[model samples]
Target: MRTRIITAIVALAIFVPFVIKGGIPLTILISLLGVIAVGELLFMKKRLLVSFEALVSFVAVVVTILPNSFWRLLPAPAFLNPRTLIYLFIFLLLLTTVLSNNKLSFDDAGALSLGVLYIGFGFHFFLQARAENWMAFVFGLIIVWLTDSFAYIIGRKLGKHKLIPKISPNKTWEGSIGGTAVATIVAIIFAESTHFATHFSLFEIVLATLVLSIAGQFGDLIESALKRYFGVKDSGTLLPGHGGILDRFDSMLIVMPIIVLIGLTA
Candidate 1:
């Protein structure tokens, strides 16, 4: 617990500044995070961090994470569209299977490909949210954090039925519902307190908040499912007592994408 608290404090110290200064610096920060998140999935899959998949997937993620403006600023030769680069890298991943005489296997390449999309788009949407609306960004983070926090607190006290004991044994329906309920309320309060104006109507914002809160829980469960399948405890060891980048940002990974998909960006 102590380690977890300290890690959160330190992480925020770095995170808040980049968030406030959203530009190339923030882009660089998120790109680095996307790289690490991809690395964690590679490690979980029993792939070497220095392997071909790692190199290819890292590049794929960075390509996906780079905003449209940044991509335009690159040198002429580096002007390949993001999709073009992604497709090229993906082909390379499959090529590795044949090159290695099937040692890497088709399934391995597929997994890495999926990881690229999962981590890549997740961070890309995060960057988009920050770039699009500051309030929208904060709202998404609050949904994930408050939902997790309240779920733990209320679940311990009032939990009865397990939400999904097989994947995350600690989660309960009581906690899940209670968490979403509280998060929704808090999000509305935040919206009101900050006079969080957006193109969307207040009704739309409230509805979106509810959706994001629910999505955040699903995101948590998705990561838990991944860990269960990998037979590992944490995603990585980067954060003390907090697991890894994925562990810390798993909920956000899901929320960020939904924030854009559902037009939560103010």
Candidate 2:
């Protein structure tokens, strides 16, 4: 717990500054995070296969996150868009699998491709959300953090029914409910206390909060599933108590994309 608190403090120290200075600094910070996350995903596989997948994932993330202006500055053709790059990398992974004579199975190829797209696109949306509205981004982060914290605390104290014992044994239905309730209250308070209510209707704010909170929980479960599949406890040991970049930001990964989508339509 002490380690977790310390890590959170240190993370906020670095994160808050970049968030406030949201420009090249934020871009660079997020890009580095994306790279590290991709590296951790690739590290799930054997060492021999890690290099190829890591390189491909890194390229995919860079393509996804780079601004249109950056692409324009390059003399590359119009076909060099993010979608094309992702598909091309997937194709290459498939080819590598074939050439390896079954050393890399179809499952491995598919997993690698999915990892690249998932991690890359997740950060892509995160960058978009931050670019769209820093306040909204901060709000989303608060919701995710509070949900996770409340769930842990409440679950450990009063939880009985297992939410998903197969995926995450520690999580409980009571915890999930408590977390969502607390997060929703926070959202309401945040809306009333800040300018969020003025920009968004009360209904829209409530709906977005509910969706983000639930999505955040599911996101954590999804990461837990991935770790389980990889036969690992944590994604990486980069963060003392939190685990890795993915472990730390799994909720944000899902929340950011949903928030961006909601922001677009709302």
Q: Which prediction has the highest TM-score against the true structure?
A: 1
Deviation of model 2 at 75, angstroms: 4.9
- Compute each candidate's TM-score over C-alphas: 0.95, 0.92
Tens digit of per-residue lDDT, candidate 2, span 1-266:
89999998998898889988877788788888888887787777653434675677687777777655566678889897767887898888798788888687888778877777777678777877777777787788889989999999999999999999999999999999999999999977887687753768787788878888999999999999999999999998888898999998899888988888776323
| Lowest lDDT 10-residue stretch of candidate 2 | 45-54
For model 1, the stretches where C-alpha displacement exceeds 4 angstroms are: 75-79, 195-198
Candidate 2 segments exceeding 4 Å error = 72-75, 197-199, 264-266
C-alpha RMSD for every candidate? 1.6, 2.0
Enumerate residue pairs that collide in model 2: none
lDDT of 2 at 157: 99
Error of 1 at 93 (Å): 0.4
